[model samples]
Target: MSQTLRVLGTSVTLLESIRQRAEAELGIRLQYQVHDTQTAQRIAVMHPERYDLYDQWFHNLDFVWPARAIQPIDTRRIALWDEINDLPKLGRLHPDDRLAHGSLPCDRLFVQPDGRLGSRPGTQISMLPLTHNADSFAYRPEHLPAALAGREESWSWLVDESWCGHIALQNDAAIGALDAALALQASGLARFDNLGNLRLEEIDQLANCLIDKQRHGHFAGFWSDDREASALMLGPRVHIQSLWSPTLMQLHRAGVKYRLAVPKEGYRAWFGGLSLSRCVQGPIKDAAYAYLNWWLAGWPGAVMARQGIYIANPLRTRDHLSRAEWDYWYDGRPATEQLPGSDGLPLIDPGEVREGGAYAQRMGHIGVWNAVMDEHNYLVRRWGDLLRTAR
Candidate 1:
């Protein structure tokens, strides 16, 4: 009866942050029940009422079934929902993902972003897309072929075979081994979903290839975090890492000389959102909504976009971006602070990527990326084995 909300989530760091914020701002306390993908789904079944809220992928993946299990939010409460007012959030999401947030908002939906505001809110205003795992090329400028310069009309270059060795791929085979599949996809090597699927064999082939390159020191290093990838670019002899775009953005600013590209072969994406448990009712609900509202407006919105995950709210401002942030994501900017042979880098900003579709809109994603995360062990292990024996 007192206002304590139990949130079922994946990350302890994220949940901890929420717990702290809830206590500080609204005087509410959130009790989080942590679960990885598999565990979370089971939690959805076993203790339907045990959780007041659930963290989910925004793409209507496995996490969405919980919504089917929970009560659909009724739009009849529009005014009660309208009580929260702050707007002008950062959106500029991929055009294709627009439907993801057509009707929802912090207004009625009980969702919040750890990066702040991720994907979209649902049509019924019940759910929110929290984050996006979008794939774009992360390359060092010095490593780019001078021939590919000025021809940035589309994304055919990454898969050209000519650009192979300089590439740094994600180490995990099954889950992280997407771009390899994407390479197969882009090159017409094999095709699956825009949000694709990979057979065990294809995954193995990629894994072996990755291992071969890795052992030979064909990479700068494996990137564990977006920021770490950025550091790799800014640090030593590493030229490219095909991880997340966040690191590329950072490297671009540090004068590291890099490029985050959208491949002609196409890029990959995976995103997640939030859902509230059915039996959740009353005061705790209000506090949750409050947290969501504050998170989507002003500074928080800008921070999220700058971090590289895509957003869904049009109300978030385009102007909120710092010049470097604007240049990195919106426009194609070089990675280093200086031209490879020059003393200092000039502020080079191209136009199309500036008006670019959101990653949520353009790239095909790993539907419910978290679902496949569990398979990563099998995937990585198999890939590693092939790398040793074959490649």
Candidate 2:
């Protein structure tokens, strides 16, 4: 009987190349279940037996860690533990940014000697840092009128009356709320004291604004999966919408011209990593460890870099890429030659510069990280109401 490891995560981590490579190299089969952020969190917490590992954003630690569904990962088990970026270890990427704003990587990341998750460094960690990057909306340049050429990009455009009924928004509440809040503030609709963790009243305000916009036909549609998001961008002709990096690459590869905006309010940053399920043991547990190590071995990171996702340990990925790939993806220079997407086919044209400039410049502009608010339950209920009415 062949060994199989069950993993649950978002579509980003379930790439075909990564899976095939792991299987071929590690001699284990992988059964991957894809879910939206909320659904993945629910499964990881409520039914830990269904998966051996979970890859998700740090914001979800609020729920999953309390449920005790995952076990601490010993740094010694990971092959390249020392090489991982210090941004998470230091808590803040830049001196000026608050610890709360940059994915909160320091809080509850390490597993302490007492077996509780904490910021103080120890032998164990809650998760193996994987891929992370800043997120922003994308728009079709040709759709804009010549009169508005070179207009500064802003999240407020999502709620602008000019694009009414032609805009799309993400379906997930945790992220969608942040995006909406950013837009609400940018558009002068309303403001929140803390965009990452909204108060109940602030949640209500944002939800009410979203409902009003939906009722007035402001949103063309809401998308949950990458395919649905891609459809919105390529078909039915959405002018602007919230986008993931991979989906933007998909649109670009398909010959659709789109521009990823570096919004004036700053980018929404996030960090994601892999966690072991409490149920994994014996051979399956060993296979899970192998898989995690394989993820940090550089090839997977190189594959993801094509889609604009940065790995936790960039030095490892450096070995797997050509100088040009490294320069174009990390240094934010114009591509000297055509570069392949995750599929290993040429996607980026020569001389095209990456949006948002270099990695440091991009990370420096982070306004807020994705987060689950203290009032997440209420936020979800209100978000559901908007979805139902919009549909």
Candidate 3:
């Protein structure tokens, strides 16, 4: 009997295609456990036996690694090991390109002989890099005032008094704080010394500002998952909110008119990948390696490409994608022909241009990464308070 490889992650990585292909091709039974970022992080650290693999953003390392909940993956086991993008290896790119502010630092990506994460070159990694993308807010043009309809995109719009009671924000504390800080900085409400690793004072100031807005009816709601976010856009009718690329894609496919803003301040970037649970061993461990290898094999990357995420190894993904798909998704070219969504059904019509332009252009504008700061515990406490009392 095939052992079930229980995987825990946010909804983003639980793609139907990935599940179907892994079971059918790799011959492993998968049990996907989806949770919000915060909850998932907690479960992975405190309940390792419940899962065999953890797929989440790099910020998770701050919490998961110290708890010793996950084991480092041997690079040799990953079939595309050499093809994987290692920030340390890419000397030709600009410094910012090599290390975005909010992403995992190059020094902490590898496993040292002592079983701790370090920067030195090694055959083991904390996580196998999966998909990454830049994120920003989306808005319905029809909901904007005529004066601001075509105005320059700004994060300030999220907290703008003009849209009070018509806006929504993400429920995830770490990322939500980043978005709030960006808006605060853009609007001159407050400033942070480091937006990515927000200090306690900075968190308080920003959270206070958001709570004030909430008290004044500045928010329509907070969404915990993609479906909730999509529902907010369609039901209660949120005009603006922090959005994920997949949610934007879903809205577009449903014929909802929206535009993903290229905020003047820059985009909040994020990277996610797969990691092995400390409890996994023997056949389960072998199967986990197989699953990680499959992700880097190209087809999975191609499926993620349709959702606006780029695989860690771009060159390999080319083999699994059509010319038009590659051009439109990565090169920023207008679609030369109708394109398919992650489901392989036609979604984009010919001539539709991707938001934020090409991959290089979008990536070049990363202002901060989704991150867990030094004050994470405090932030979570206050964030919980905001959720309960903000109304």
Q: Residues 1-391, candidate 1: write the lDDT tens digits.
A: 2578677755412334445655676667767787644466567756768777766543233234434544444333333334322220122233343221211222234422421223344335445444444565666566677776666522334344446545455544433455555554555545543223445565555565545545654444544445555666666555555666445445545656555665554445544445656676687666556555544443344444544555444235346655655445434453323211111233334432422354333533222132243234566577566444423
Candidate 3: Cα lDDT at 152: 94
- Candidate 1: segments with Cα more than 4 A from true spot: 1-56, 59-127, 130-134, 146-166, 171-175, 187-195, 209-220, 277-285, 293-299, 316-391
Q: Is candidate 1 or candidate 2 better by lDDT?
A: 2
lDDT (tens digit, per residue) of candidate 2 on 1-391 = 2898988998987887788888899988988889876688889999999999998988887788889999888788887888887767775557876454524776768987777777899978888878888899998887875645778989888888877888898998888878888999999999889888888888889989889888888989889877889999898658999999989888998999889999988988888889999988999988889889988899999998988999988878989988989999999999999899989999999999999998877877888888878788998999899899888
Give the alpha-carbon lDDT of every model. Answer: 0.47, 0.86, 0.84
TM-score per candidate? 0.57, 0.95, 0.95
Which one wins on lDDT?
Answer: 2
How many clashes in each candidate? 23, 0, 1
In order of TM-score, best first, we have 2, 3, 1
Better of 1 and 2 by TM-score: 2
CA shift of 375, model 3, Å: 0.7
**Per-residue accuracy of model 3 over 1-391 as CA lDDT, tens digit each:** 3778999998887987789888998988999998887689889999999999999977788888999999989998887888876532341125556355554545467888998877788888898877888899998888886757667999988888878888888888888878888998998999888888888888899888888778877888888888888989887558899999889888989999988999988888877889899999999999999999989989899999998898888878999889999999999999999999998888899999998998778877877888888888898888877787655
